[model samples]
Target: MSAVLASVAGAALNIGTNPLAIAGLVPIVAAGLTFLRYLRFDPEDHPVSVQKLLPEYDFVIIGGGSAGAVVASRLSEIANWTVLLLEAGPDENEVTDVPSLLGYLQLSNMDWMYQTSPPTDSQYCLAMIGDRCNWPRGKVLGGSSVLNAMVYARGNKRDYDAWEAQGNPGWSYKDILPYFRKSEDNRNPYLARTDYHNSGGYLTVQEVPWRTPLAVAFLQAGKELGYDVRDCNGEKQTGFMITQTTMRRGHRCSTAKAFLRPVRHRENLHIALNSQATKIIIDRRTKRALGVKFVRSGRNKVVRAKREVILSAGAIGSPQLLMLSGIGPKEHLESLNIPVISDLKVGYNLQDHVGLGGFTFIIDDPITFTRNRYQSINVVMEYLLREKGPMTSQGVEGLAFVNTKYAPKDGLWPDVQFHFAASSINSDSDQIRKITGMRDSVYNTVYKPLGDAETWSLLPLLLRPKSTGRISLKSSNPFVYPDINPNYFTHKEDILTLIEGIRIGLNVSDTPSFKRFNSRPHKMPFPSCEQYEFDTDEYWECSIRHFTFTIYHPTSTCKMGPENDGDAVVNPRLKIYGLENLRVIDASIMPNIVSGNTNAPVIMIGEKGADLIKEDWLGQHFRKT
Candidate 1:
């Protein structure tokens, strides 16, 4: 049994070096893969052949990601309007469907594998490889949704209201709540019945079907600390609850699955996978986006968009595409010898939820998830046959939104978000370390010694960061990767806020609920911070700087605001400020970063952006709400 379990673990991690162990699990592995294949786990729902490319389409959307998928699907509902979605990567496969393996998906071929270019004086990400952090954006059809842990959070009500206050009309919580509901098909009976949530939508939102005892204990601990255990996505944002995921029947339901698959039969919608859009063919004199130039199958192709061209290429890709198409800052474009078109701030105002990664709490019991404990034939079989097992878990089981001292006292808005993991970073046999770009010395000294011990962790993420970053063009070449400078912890207040968050997390772990299992902070101090006494604010601050982590929620590069806002790249209607018939409809257009995981809000943006487009072309009567 132990040998079989080892084989299963080896096969699952794809690091099985033992020929004998691999040979023993070949049959089981083969059967599971074949079963998933039979279920059509691949995102081949749409039959889009290269030969089917037409001379022109009414709308050319560059990217088949979270927002692009929704935009393409919704626009194609009109029979007369032709929509083309060009994705840089291929369709998702069975490997991406398994929720438990979310971490492994990063740094793989499916990920864009972006690395941040931290300034020399930056104190954060010090322990990472080359003093840089890995930014794993999905390169698949579903984009980052295919790579994320499937946390379905819409952020605080004030987040959208703030956007409206920032001169973006029709973006308040009340105004956009319908759009959130329009795309949600909530599986939870209670939430589905609420006015805030609805049923019979394209996206499936529900609690993770399976969780460990530690996850339940996490909620109890939150309650002990005077936090509510109610729905975090519903009436109140400041509370604790089991994580709601974008999943269906224990499988990851990416945007491509939810939005694109249903409309695959639409003759007006065409998806071009592995088509990298190099530039937006714009009429300079008219300032109109005419078409898109993309390369597919080693061939260059330009397709005309009769009406509009939309960039739904996410925060990173959208700004990069804009800059490459000569729509960035005048000075920066001139430095690269590219003629400036719009001369707007394309990649400024970048923000992400930065957190501390190695804050682990040890427990006496063996209840926490570890690769060795759950990687067995029975577990695999249960997931395959019944879609119920540890494999269904997305690792993140519980969540809490709490207000720090820095947060405003008038509202329920939280400045800190806690992600409760059933297992610690050390539980995955260095997979987290590899994905996060942790140095060998740090992982070997701090986490490696833990060796799959029963442990849990609460990752305290700064929900509202004061420090902003930017994405800049590396060269005029569209194929060249852009430089991402997250510039985390640049503000002293940001560090202070995170320190308070860490204190709250520690307080939760010290509660009676967690104390029942004899839970205690892991004693190993980070290598660079060993000089300071452990558990002190000084020590923790140093630890945070060394282990600074990105929650993968980069946004606000092409900020949406009124025309007078100097930093605004897109107008309130999501149209490019200085151009006609061009708009950015992804997370890039966020005026400010939302308070939680960005996937749900990004999908909402797509739904609302689609309506905005409809109103512009088909008149105001075409609006849904």
Candidate 2:
């Protein structure tokens, strides 16, 4: 009887909606979970805990995140080198491995949950809690890679070429392509056979195993708009395709899983979990970073590094740590009564990918994903048994890169990127709204009314935003979060570019392929923008200010450039100017943010940084592929 009921419930879920499906499969799923619990299937291998810390290591890397994990893993390959990785949070568990639960992880303990400070004169994030945008960075072992949407997008080739053009050597697309390929193990057969992608590497890149029909229509709509359905990561920068994710067999394969777990048994590598790095201990007279000061288990501790102390604490944390260690602007450090070590710009030139949210297209079909329908017991069973279902979907199913009118006329680069989500803001029943820090009033007025209706949305992201922000020290304390002012849309060109992106998104919705499902724009006007006519330029711009969205790609706080560049904190070799034995190996070192998602590019940065270290210390001949 149980087997028969389970089969019927599974069939009902395949059709996307059956109220009784959940009730019927509950018992079967409960029993299956109980049976599985007895098997003790642990997906993650527990790293051996360090009961006592050695006084010194050959290398100490801060923040065991995306880049830190890779650096620690690769450096430990040298048998004689002792490496210590300090992570402020605990390890990732089975729950975090589920791709569909990414939204739920944002405000949870796994995330740093940093919120952007309210702009003094701007209207951005006006509808959010305290008018601040939530900036979620991963605090766990893999850092943001464990918390991100898992999109593995590598930006345009020209983006890196532009970096080399800025007086930085060996950062051009051709020079860095090997590092990108060295870390990627493309699981897609067709993509793997290409010259651009490789087959065997630590990070697994593949298309998500499951997606809604809305993803299919999004690609078709791109073709109807005269765009090619080609690989956006290969050959060209402007096109549409199914998003490739950093997933393996339908589970999130974060940097911790990819680089750290496999090498957990290495005796030279030591990881200190739940350890917060308070400061980089730089010798005041010599200006050399010698070690790290941290607090672990309510006890303050200090560990020295014989060779180098690498900072991979991410965009926000890296700047904050540097500033806390008196490695910031001279005036700011003196104001806090901290002694200045190197008065270089530590947190300027902050950039992120901003997008306009709440652009929903209501569709008549039941193919779009909904929380209640897809989160049923039958769906859980399908995932647990076959590793295939809506649980495998990364929410963002398809992506399209388009060049807006504001972009360069060269036609090879894209200024705006579109993220096609099978589920919209309201489709998850206010889960996304609450996590994004949206106000109750705004949610009730704009999104709540949509209820359980099937809907899809195209989040038009400003790929290369001209507006730059800053990260500053809130106080001398290391535990206090930094003041992040993205200063979004402060530049006039940013708002204009975003508005053009919206117009293009609307055009994509109007394509013939989208019309197959009777898809149409949700034409409700925001209560704040009711004065303007709906769907007009004025109305859309008003909506954009009220519902500004961030794609969580903050970068370039500690920029890399030549010696003459005043804004540069690090040189072309990624070493902090005027300081010795210290380097930053994360997204924070980017001179400019990439054209698309930042996770893959950051992992690539890690690979290149590891090689750079080898070249500096072990000579160029010791560099790995």
Candidate 3:
């Protein structure tokens, strides 16, 4: 065996790699080599074919991100068509493949590292970075999928139904289900036979092997609270279940790895890394998107597209690019001296899942990912060889979706999502200090005391908020980060809804299943809540304001609706209104944010959008013939 193979085998041997174990190593080793080669033999090392040679293409998809990767890969399958994918960052490395290291990736080199503008009118994130929350969008090839905690959640059916009701014709629940199934390769046998899932597809959805005992207790607690143990993403969403992750063979199945990597050998598909798209090449006279202008290695290059220029740069990047190309709100573009092409509301209606980060429960036993025992060399070996153990676990393992009493009585969809995380006490505070750019004084005062305690945290995420925010230009410069204001809790109803969510969670923790482990609320009293009694509604309200941070699901900035809908930027077909041959195919096009983690839904969007594009062009070609 080669030295590298021998070393890997040695780790497996230590764990007693039986015949079955040895067989599993083959694919793992192959994927590793494939990933390594993709990184090492970058297009930059060769001739500038990715740049100069592809000056004109049948299609140009900017951003090799979650949606961008899928669109480019699917479109290039036509074989006759040439596609160019431009990414602003480097390729995905080994670090991004490990699920446990997801937290550290935020604000790292692979992250966009955008921070929301400090709350102007609300104190929702007062304890965070300069009173602003860290907004970590992925800068790597797979985009946020490489950076996100890989929970595979397809939002409730009603979410898409609501979109179709709002004049988007082909976006009803039934309409999108086929696309969701098209991209999913469900590995869990329990879900495989279910009508909601499909196997033999690109994205692998499976239950992680290693799960904390406390997480199991959380599920049990859900049962005791009268909630059924249903597949949260299956027929019903209102129940507790262990989160399904986007992983395969204990490695992250990022869109780049799942969808893009396998198809990299296709000659028609070209990828350019470290190439930042500075502006979309829009024809001012005709308002047609012709191609893109990008900067790579400090040189400006233009690539034209004969067919279409699709923007999959995500919620923040897509809108910023559009406004930079002068295809946004007229007054805003005029302020920056960017002459308007289509006076559309490109950067309005920003929405996100704002999660309450302070609520935690201290348990008696030390059964958590951060406990020292699980961080040993043996555990690492188990993961390297068998694709099992703590390293495979996406940190927040147990998840529950519930409707608060405040939810509309007639509505079947859940309004709140609860994520149960097994933590070695104060993990959030430690993470904030180490990764989220928070101050030591705040960490010491607010989070230090709980460091050694065995704890499990329950974060209540508001799925739908009446309050909306926006992304606006900091300057005319494309590189300058836009001002992100989630404007969390601007509506009093949002805070009231979360207060009910907290009460419901505390009720679940009080259940006999959780009580067996001596689970009780971790009391880190915030000084801001001193006026109210501990555990009371007023106190929890204060706590929510101080501790609420982003669950990172941002959408609807490039709103999708019929042209008559005043706020709509993209039509039902996802084409930018008044602009020919250009489409926005990312989270930004959501008429409203989905009711769960946005990653899975976003991938489905990519799959659905690619089909629409294919249907449109292929039909046209057939007609011409």
Model 2 / residue 391 / CA error / Å: 0.5
lDDT per residue for candidate 1 within 1-625, as digits (tens), equals: 4464466565656744444454345345634553454355544464454456998999999988889999998999889999999999988876688888787789888889999997654688888999899999988888999999999999999999999998888999999899999999999998899988998999999888899998878889888988889889898899999999999878888999899888788888889999999999888898999999999989999999999999999999999999889999999999999888888999999999998988898898988887667765556667766778888899899999998999999649999999999886765656777888889999889888887578898899999999999999998898889999998888888999899999998898899999999988887888888999977878988998999987899999999999899999999899998799999999999999999999999999999999999999999889594
lDDT of 2 by residue, 1-625 (tens): 4664466566655745554555344334534543453244445475765768899999999999989999999999889999999999888866677788777778888889899999885679877888899999999999999999899999999999999999899999998888889998999999999989998999999999999887888889888888899999999979899999999878788999899988999999999999999999999999999999999998999999999999999999999999999899999889989899899999999999998888898988888887667777667768766778988888899999998898989778999999999786765655677778888888888888887888899899999888899999889988888899998988878888888889889888898888988888998877898899977778888888888899799999999999999999998889999999999999999999999999999998898888888888898788476
Deviation from truth (RMSD, Å), model 1: 3.5
What ranges in model 3 sit over 4 Å off? 1-52, 425-430, 620-625
Error of 1 at 79 (Å): 0.4
Residue pairs in collision within model 1 = none
Q: Rate the local accuracy (lDDT) of all candidates.
A: 0.87, 0.87, 0.82
- For each candidate, what TM-score against the reference? 0.95, 0.95, 0.92
lDDT of 3 by residue, 264-330 (tens): 7789888898899999998888878899999899998899999999999999999999999998999
The residue pairs in collision within model 2 are none
Better-scoring candidate (TM-score), 2 or 3: 2
